[model samples]
Target: MKIRVEKPKRPAFLVPAVIIFLVIAAVFFAVHSFTETSVPLAYEITGFEGQVQIFDLSNHEWRDPRRGEEFKAGQKIRTGVDGILNLQVENSVRLRVKENSMLVNRECKLQKEVEIYRLGLDEGVIFGAMAKNLDRKIADNKAEFVVSTPQFDAKPFGALFRIQASEKADENRVGVLRGVVEVSRPGSLSGKGPMFNVRALEEAEVMEGRVQSPAKISAETWQELKEGYELLAKSAVMEAEQIDLAQKAGNFFEKAVFDHGTFFTPKVGYAGREFFKDPDSGEVYLETEYDVFPAGSFVGVYIKTRDFDISKYEGLIFDARRKGDEGFPDSFFIELKSKGSVLRKYSARGFLREWTPVDFKFNAQKPTLINEVVFVFTNERVGESKKGVLEFRNFTLTPKKDPVPVAPAIPVNVTDIVSPPEIQSTPVSEPSAAPSNQTSGQETFDEMVPQTISLG
Candidate 1:
């Protein structure tokens, strides 16, 4: 009885201290759970080829990544001269990094009501496609995909787009193929400069920290954008098929004009060129009208090849058709030139009003360097018509061996001309002064064709 009575009284602060400790632990657990839930899953590399290398933030080293490997935020990817990398994010967005590109994953977050992805492009081009209705899981859900560059940032709203950046030149270009892309300078995002909205089939450029006005995309750029979107669409369903198809398609686009060529029309008076997209089939093509002043004058368009090694390729392939019911010249010439001299000249005949596939196999003597590809139209072939419209698209170099069968190759005869003849018109110094006769509703030929060449 005496020992029980000797029990000491409990300290006043002990209970309160225990309660405070419990409250602090509860707060810490809640914050940690929130962070875990807010973090986004890693991006999955679906396919890659050539010298694609990845730099991991955790490892701090660049390593060759395999298909199906996961890439996390803070990681960087660099593609070599022939490299291509394909990635999938949250099953809703697909990205293709073109050759000689460097991309960095800055932020990726997927929450119950919102998904955010931000990427940094240091150099080269990247194609992106965001699936429509990505927020179908929740009515209030939203998604934001942004690509930041040295000069500008591109924000796409469930669209297909391409963003190119040149850190060396401090230039950025944004092109949209299917939807709208908001292009803004880095300072403009903070309400400094004006923002530009580039819509479907349009492009905008940013140089010297200024965003240029949006304009229609060129035929070559359109083809590049279309090919990239098609590749992503085809691979959306199956991962295994995606890897195989992406490699093959990547190789094809690398050598073709779609990746590193400049399509342009010479500053001549006889020809007017414009890019047209078919509303029905969604096919993009180059439409050219030739108005030969003299009965025998010639007109043409040129694609700068940038001296790509076509030794692995067998020949040239393209699609052409006559616009409307107008009769086209039976003789169409395709000349491969190196340095200003014609390397090989091939002539094709029998073009129909409907689209026809034309392929020309190189002769035994293939040039080691091909600087330009010219499509020449001579009024002499059409006799006294002296005027015609032609549509062309899908100009590519055929691989030496293709697994799938292609259209029957048309027989092309070699021409003896060593060089193209000079035009007989005075050069118009101003684009506005260009003849508006053929391009009434379209942009002037001089304005439509870019004077400076960009190798992809």
Candidate 2:
């Protein structure tokens, strides 16, 4: 009987095959778990009142609304009750999302040629420091960027600025502070929709889901908008004065005047105190002629930096033009004087009888706190040039903000960890929808978008 059983038929060897398959699957999963790379860039929440949930698609699910948390991309941050969030994106960009504001990433891509951030600004304000490269293009090419509101049924393009965008209904107002921006409205009048450069400021009212006719803002607001610009222009003249005074020990700061167009207004020289004039056509030109120092008499425009502490400022930037005379004395100079000494000086180059952007970084050493800045046009050369005219505009003094606190220190020792017995904040009451000057009926808004501003 034992011989007839044929050694029990060897059980088909199925057990070993099953064991081997399980072992291979386990090894593959173990390797895959260790290879995935997460984003290295971090984000910190600077300020927030209530518990806000920020959703990031890539990493994990949720982020604390509290201060000092890391943030990654595709994160949808929701404000709880009354929440104010200040998020620092990519280290250099600062984003402050106001309460009741909802921002969604429509599309964002970083490619070889350009980085595009298409964001939806729904019911709030988003302030950003555009990437330095974009700033460079704006300063160099005079290129203008566009921002639009999509949900509203008029035009896709909304308010555009250098790096600021705001959306509000009824009493909505958006403006450009330093760079060029184009506002495009839907219509056959393609060339229309105002083009703002430098200090060209405007605001439009949104009603009934449409941007309506612009309302007049007070001069106080206008002054506030133009304040930073005026100070910047004055600083240029102040720099020139410091150099001239140091060279000869005289009062040049007080006598310094903005020699070129300020805020794109053609500087009125050989005329009264007005630097430029605004015609109905909105064409600003600089038509000024003055005999600069053929041997360095210090001819330049001044900008006052009274309210701003530019000690940490990185540089002075602006656009310049040399027209009419092909070989005029366009050699320029920039100098920064601190206390009683000329701290820094930079000689101009690449003046090729065309409009050019000039960016000069200031030395990190203590600056003159530049109450005045000067842009010098020198005529001291072999040419028989006596008068030098160089038109300048779009001046900006950029300061580096204090390094933003990145991550909260993590405690290692058990004794160092103090569980902050979670203190809760008093919730603010949400206001009901009340009509004010800033809000208007939807019907009125619909009629306003297409209506042209009556010239009469």
Candidate 3:
């Protein structure tokens, strides 16, 4: 009787329809889960030093984060004098936050189609490294990665680069050690003005919404910045192996004239100074040409300025190179000047038509009045050829400051490249005015996908 009553109420269509709906729903969910990416919701703290503080988003509180603490999107972080912070992004990316600096995780949204990662530096410096072999072709790397500051924005495809925001000047400087970086001004996501590319050993300045062309930096000058950042973020064993304590650094570029000097070609032998950009790396260098060979005389260039009193500086730092020219002189000379020439000229080597970083230490006593600096090239050095193009940039007379610690060599290993769509940064629309300490030429940057400019 019970079985007959139950069977009488049952609908044949109802069971099948319900079962089909459940099957369809399960299939849809399984497909969606399979296509989703396994991205982390936050960056995990790896290491830290000094007095570091973080603003937690969940609790809305400022507190010290322990190792393995997570920094979510929009989390604010700052470091004190003794403060250094290290963080891991995914499995391949890393961040080193320097002392006396402030920054935030600007974006960490990984959607189905692509992911965008950004960090904002309000003041101070930060160094970042990313693996080169990232699978950019996959669906998640549309923006690649970027670091933004008060003055500019950097889209470093996969790079080792540093960002310094000067609290006083309200400007920002980016130093690239490896790979390629796209530099543009703030609010230029539309890439309003000319976009600049920076390569290894290059530095760019961003101020008042304009991007200075990239220029070469001395290895020591760069090391100071790079290693200093490393010291604050990582271990300080490498700092012990560096050069003398930094007393003071007089950046030749701080002045308007930039201590630009004359290339004395009194005779018919001529030389000219111009600025050129490397189309590939987007590096800027001052290009000077010695047109005709003149024996025992200089068709060279010099930079002398009374605007700066660099007496505190123990030596001068600059980078020089010769373009791919067999006609270029085999050697060049550097001179430092004051009321009287406290002359210790450095003989140029490594002029194999490539950029070379040189640190000219003072042989004599520090100059009494270092109001002038000079770089002289003459026909005396070359064996057969006297005419050539001299490429030079990064003229700084640094002072001796207290020794800063150095970081041990990081064991980051990267092999390969990343490729994404054309980012907001594009090539310069038109050639910028011929600027001091800049060079322009065609190089191949397009072929290298998802370039990384290493700060190290």
Candidate 4:
């Protein structure tokens, strides 16, 4: 009877049911954990030129204070900040992302002989040097650097980007300093089909969720883009100009100086100097009437323009030459001034034995309408009293088409430190005992005229 009472009959399905329950519990835990703690893929942001950053999935947040923090790819980030994030690209280039920006690097693919990287720039600004991969067509041309944004795109090489502003604007805007760039929808019909190749440097505007044609952009914005390109492009020219300006003594306006019977002294100080080219000699160099030593040193020139409004020109362009050591100083520099204030500075670093064209902006990302120009030579290698040779030619300040009307010139009273009334072209014996009365005028020859050469 006791045995028959039977072990409480075990349910036939009890074991299997327990096992199933356990499995179900494990699955639930796994799913919950995944949903709670998983994150997007992170980008491998490193290169010879610099490092990169990724933003977390936070919209409309500022990252300025938290810069230098690592961000994973696919994690969304919005730039409410107002600064630039600098990253290295090529061994020789840098990439800078500005504030209020949204961008992502989708992929970095390295194939058998190709290294391809794709980036999605939603909004903001980017500045960097261009790299030439041995496997890509870029190595052949070098000038085609690619910049993509929601509204604009560009390719800037052998140059620098001072600023790129892409706020919620009426149009997509992209500009370059030196090299050429191509802009198009990578594979969109608006940019043509995937089979079609896009054109380089297309000026388009992004407005109301649509990218409009370049013709629709405002004159002011167009002027900004043009000015930006000029500023970036000027770096190379300034480098070459140093050599040309250093070699000559009297620069270009020797006739004007002699005709006016005014003695020109060397103004070798930092702020005030001029680079002039002979209208007839075709040789160019720096000129001043303040006897200061510029031997074996880098000096800059400042051109005081007539009281005229500068808003009309998008930028400045000129020609220059150098005949010194094959590769002397690596670069040259230029600066501008307005209303007794400094306007802009441009540096062109490279060689220029042949007459090369150079362009730079008076105001990048905007137009700074003023009438003064300054040329600067860096003291990169020169000691005291060293001589360098450089020549400038065919300088022109052409205004952008339909530029804002030139502003009327403002009369400025500049006080000079050196005032030698007479300049003797003939080398005076024993340097004429360091003249004491140093009172200089804007132009040593009170009547020096601005020089220009036709581009055509």
Name the better of 1 and 2 by lDDT: 1
User: Who wins the lDDT comparison?
Assistant: 1
Stretches of candidate 1 off by over 4 Å are 1-37, 111-113, 133-141, 168-171, 187-193, 235-456
Q: Which sections of candidate 2 miss by over 4 Å?
A: 1-52, 56-62, 65-73, 80-83, 88-93, 136-173, 184-199, 212-216, 220-456
Candidate 4 Cα deviation (angstroms), residue 177: 3.4
lDDT: worst 10-residue window of model 2? 265-274
Instruction: Give the winner by lDDT: 1 or 4.
Output: 1
lDDT of each: 0.66, 0.43, 0.61, 0.43
lDDT tens digits, residues 29-119, model 2? 9998776443234446777776467775667667665578755445566665577676554413445565555655544444333444444
Write candidate 3's Cα lDDT for 1-456 as tens digits. 455444466778999999999999999999988886746467889889899999987789989988998888889999999899988765356788888999899887665645667788898888877652332422244535777887788877545678788755545788765456789887565668678988655788876767899987653535444442232222233222111111111245454133343455444345555443444555555655553343466655555566454435655666777654225666665554555554334566556455666775442223344445554566666555544566666667667666689989967546645656776876678867765752221121212111111111
Q: What is the TM-score of each candidate against the true structure?
A: 0.47, 0.35, 0.43, 0.34
In TM-score terms, candidate 3 sits at 0.43
Residue 398 lDDT (model 1): 70
Task: Please give the ranking of all candidate structures by TM-score, highest first, separated by commas.
Answer: 1, 3, 2, 4
RMSD each, Å? 21.5, 30.8, 25.1, 24.5
For model 2, what is the alpha-carbon lDDT of residue 73? 41
